[model samples]
Target chain A: MHKVVTVDMEKDILAENRRLADENRALLEEHDIRAFDFLGAIGSGKTLIIEKLVDHLKSKGKESAAIAGDVSGDDDYQRLVAHGIPAANISTGKECHLDAHLVDHALEDLPLDKIDYLFIENVGNLVCPVDFPLGSHVRVVVISVTEGDDMVRKHPAIFAFSDVIVINKIDLAEAMQVDPRILERDARRINPGAKIVKMDARHGNGLDDLISALGL
Target chain B: MHEFSVMSQIIEGLLEESKKWSAVKVEEVFLDLGDFTMLGEEQLKFSYEILSKDTILQGSTLTINHVKGTIECDCGFKGEMSPSEDSPHRIVPILECPKCRGPARIISGRECTIKNLRLVVPDV
Candidate 1:
């Protein structure tokens, strides 16, 4: 009573996401906003590093806005707002990473013309975030020394796709018994072109190198 | 964690494709997963099994083909870099050019695609 119904797809599973990302990129470009996707693990200082970068940019008279993605809570979003930076939060609920569609929606709330740079802080996960690009001009992955020296080797794909890699919490290197140089070396091994910077973002150390790396 | 979302996307795509032919049921699905993608096949299948319920894709067989990561470098190095030197339990992949140990452009093995689908259509 039934017959064969074969459908040949040969289509990329992430084609929808990639298409949305391209649209987001074009919109950001039209607004003359340089966007960066800040990717890292939870407690890797991505938020603090962003705070420091915001302060640094403020000193240079450059306005920067942020879009924070997290599973729950508005703590990060509130923190950025306390610093007077225009920002919005996207709660993924069950998702681990932020995709282009969510970002595209968030862009509607952000005042694009009032900012020079747009920072998208992706949900703090290394593995999944690399697969989702949020229309950022540059993608930076942050890893602290507390995560250990093998962090880069453990997640090479993030490093490979990243335009910059920030090695945060270097001030605690002696206590953590991890060398920042070794981490930088391993990161360079995986991605020779990635600009790697060591820092204690909590105290604003090494933010200049990161800023220069972004050409901001 | 993200596997569920990826599975949902596949199911949605399959449903749309089947609708184009007025399929009564989906029989099988063939997927091409690149080695560099790091998406777990077991997890994807588990997600699919649960998400496809009540849909035409229910009870469909999911076949996955792992495409190996291939590299091409300015140093004329072109081949697949073998698995890392880490222990058996911890397999860290080293994706670099074997010849110059430099940054090589990855030419392939980052694709995640739905290749084909088998479906059932009622007689006209």
Candidate 2:
């Protein structure tokens, strides 16, 4: 016996995203809160870069904080508290991705008016975050040379999603036989519009280029 | 990995939807699985079967229709992808249009959405 099935979907995801993102952008414009999202794979130094970014922003008399998403996110929360920067951790529990709803929830604790910059360090995954929008002004995708030469080829979604690509761990590039230029070339091929930065955060190299990208 | 999380939301949506009408048993749930997304159908169905059991959405079937990846060429032609059956493969022939042969910007994929919910409310 064959049975008939029909369905009615009330909400369309992309349409809803376009609509809600417009609303979030409007609120941000009204309040003057400039936000950026740091997205990358695990061990790619997204957290380290964001942590350093907070200090760099503070040196210029700009206040900034971070929203770290994790299963045990409060580690970053504690670190932020110790640094005297306001922060929160969106404990996604089992969710691999962070979305605008999570960002909206994280903002409840922030003084959006007082801060000049806000950073959202999303969960460390290339695939999941590519699909979700955080309502950020910029999406900075970080890739380390040590990960491999084929990173851009394997993760087009991540590269295409990037407004800026940070090729980190350059200090080890020579020993690892990793060419950062190749990364930039491939990124250019994938997303010609994205600016690429080569950095060794531990050595404080290329920090100025990053700051320039942030317009600070 | 995100499939489980999305499935949870779908179940929640279904439960809330079922409460709107009395004596209705869900027949089918239609969903759009984006090609850009990394969800697995086997994982989705297995998890959904377990998640929907004994709740308001008990015994419901999940149907996922995969949306094709469409890229529009710089030369004004568009078509579905024809990537080879290989792992770690880049999407190629790099947007060469069948007509004008130019680069293509991917227009689709990244649309992991729950499109429909079908239920049979008993004739009252």
Candidate 3:
């Protein structure tokens, strides 16, 4: 079916997505599976962090599967599978992000009962995904220090809506002269309550801290 | 950039409106985005071309109308103006219009919307 969000009906359309997201959130809680969302800019090391997360889970002998929704290839899924984790690639075709309905559809094809952790890696884009809730129990926004500290002011929604702030690429904080102190201030200024985890996903630095923060 | 989300909504909205009409397909999407909405024509066109494929909104033409942004000034003046380039921000005449020399008020911009869809029914 073709769906249109006309100007006159935009409110109703958004309300519907919100309602579905809430229901999905409740369902996740019922299953005792904490869903954590990883959102970030185009090259903010989100993919690497997600990959590290799968490995971390396996190192501890936990069962975790991923639902990677991308606009392009299934490289992310393969990356997870190579780590001894099962993953589902939800190719959006043309959409920038994934919604509850799409995630629900993909989950039907997976062994929901066998998996203890359901990690949904959203598309790399930051703007559209903010509005769509994919039933995640926690929403973490990852930012690369190279993207500039002003990102907090440029797109406050990502920082504001996030439950945890993962400051990736801390290793380049010196080479890139990216100051965590300023980003930290800006991040906290927008979302004072969100736990900020600084890390270099590529170097494996701070991954353990992130895992501990997630209580995994 | 955000057109895909808006287009996705437009597609969903069109499907929903189609149910109301006996029309089997839509001919044109009459979208009246709010004047305050900052939608690029090229982006919408691109998203529609891709998203409308194999859907009810396929082959449908999109008609867009640009409306003026509204502004209200503290000096008891109200008017409308286009958002500044790149900034997409505006301030009520900090003092007054350079020409009219009066405080200006802004009321709109930053609106994203799809107004209506025109559908065609099969002629039996």
TM-score of every prediction relative to native: 0.94, 0.84, 0.67
Q: Candidate 1 regions off by >4 Å?
A: B87-95
Off by over 4 Å in 3: A1-11, B11-124
What RMSD does each model have against the real structure? 1.8, 3.7, 9.0
Candidate 1: what lDDT? 0.86
Docking class of 3: incorrect
lDDT of 1 by residue, A1-216 (tens): 889866779989776787899999999999899999999999999898888888878998999999999999999999888778899999999899999999999999999988999989999888987677788999999999999988887788888778899999999999999989989988887777678898888887888889899898
How many residue pairs in model 1 have overlapping backbones? 0
CA lDDT, every model vs. true structure: 0.86, 0.75, 0.70
TM-score of 3: 0.67
lDDT (Cα, tens digit) per residue for candidate 3, span B71-100 = 554555566542333245532112123234
In the predicted model 2, the residue pairs found to clash are none
Worst 10 residues of 2 chain B by lDDT: B88-97
lDDT of 3 by residue, A1-216 (tens): 543333234333344666777777777666666677778876888778888887777777777878887898998778877877677889988888788888877777667666778788888876677656777888888898898866666765566567788988988889887788888876764455568899989989998889988877
Instruction: Compose the digit string of candidate 2's lDDT tens values, residues B1-124.
Output: 7767777777777777667655357877888876765667898898899898887577877888987767776666777744533343544222334455444577876576778787777554
Model 1 chain A: weakest 10-residue lDDT segment is A185-194
